[model samples]
Target: MSGPALPPDVIEIRGIRGFGRHGVFEHERADGQEFVVDVRLELDTRPAAASDDLADTVNYGVVAEQVHQAIESDPVDLIETLAQRIADLCLADRRVTATAVTIHKPSAPITVPFDDVVLTVQRRAGEST
Candidate 1:
């Protein structure tokens, strides 16, 4: 008789926050700014779960490093661009089924100081064109 198939598994990473210089304003972009980023990654890991192999599933450390790199790598004109780029990067991995990205800017340049501004985006691997 054939052995039963392995059950599907999911690998998740959360609460990865960092400070970076990203904004539209000249000073904000020039001098740099602070940003908090949170990300969630969903993927299938039946192989890894059964085989106990790192290569069979997504790596949380790698994902976190990638998100961090994406945020600090290039100057973005808008947070929207930054968020979208992040989601796209996570989705690039065939193993990742979906990804959620949340970015918070607490020190946004404004006439009045505010608590914070948060932007969240969710994208599925196939749903996005």
Candidate 2:
């Protein structure tokens, strides 16, 4: 017989907006633009659920703050780097087993009209940092 099943819990935060200086162009880097970040943390929620305690699970509030800080912290040439930074931050919490991060640039310097430019990345625990 199979043992007790592990809880598959995910905490998601979407559409987190912040101003950042990130891009290849000097103008883009000099002048910051709005960036939207989305994060998903996958973990077992059984402990938190069973104990009804916030300490047992990832605190999404803190996650949001960390993500925002990461975005506003430094200047990067690629959204991929930003996404990786966010993913690292999410994985910092021991409770999180994996995470996916998406970054959106709505005001990319493109002559052609487009909704947004986005990049998404996922990382799992025990993976290379």
Candidate 3:
């Protein structure tokens, strides 16, 4: 017989905005920029649903705060690094089997007119990449 079925549910947190001083250019870091983050967490919600308890599932409020903190503090030179940090934070919760983190810089330091620069990183429970 097969083991118990896992829930194929995803929790999406979108448009998390924060001020971050991250970039290659010195001025970019000095001036700082607005960063928006979106994350999709893959987890089994069956336990939470059955118990109807917040503890049985990942607390997204805490996750949002953690992601915002990652963006606002410990400025990095690359959005890749920042995205990885956010992924790591989300993966910290054992309930989350995988996570997709998207970082958007609307005010990128580009001479030409551009809408936005975005970087996304995906991480699984065990693998770093």
Provide the TM-score for each candidate, comma-separated.
0.82, 0.94, 0.93
Residues 6-124, candidate 1: write the lDDT tens digits. 54355556656665778878888778767778877787767787999999878778888988888787878888888998999888889887888888888888778689988999888
The deviation in Å at residue 94 for candidate 2 is: 1.1
Q: Give the TM-score of candidate 2.
A: 0.94
Better of 1 and 2 by lDDT: 2
Give the alpha carbon lDDT tens digit for every residue of 65-100 in model 2. Answer: 999998898899999999999999899998899999
Looking at model 2, residue 46 earns an lDDT score of 84
Off by over 4 Å in 3: 1-7
- 27: Cα error in model 2, Å: 1.0
Q: Whose TM-score is higher: candidate 2's or candidate 3's?
A: 2
Error of model 1, residue 25, in angstroms? 0.7
Please rank every candidate by lDDT, starting with the best: 3, 2, 1
In angstroms, the error of model 2 at 99 is 0.5
Model 3 C-alpha lDDT per residue in residues 45-123, reported as the tens digit of each score: 9899999999999999999999999999999999999999999999999889999999999999888999999999889
Error (Å) of candidate 2 at residue 117 is 0.7
lDDT at 112 for candidate 3? 98
Models ranked on TM-score: 2, 3, 1
Name the lDDT of candidate 3: 0.93
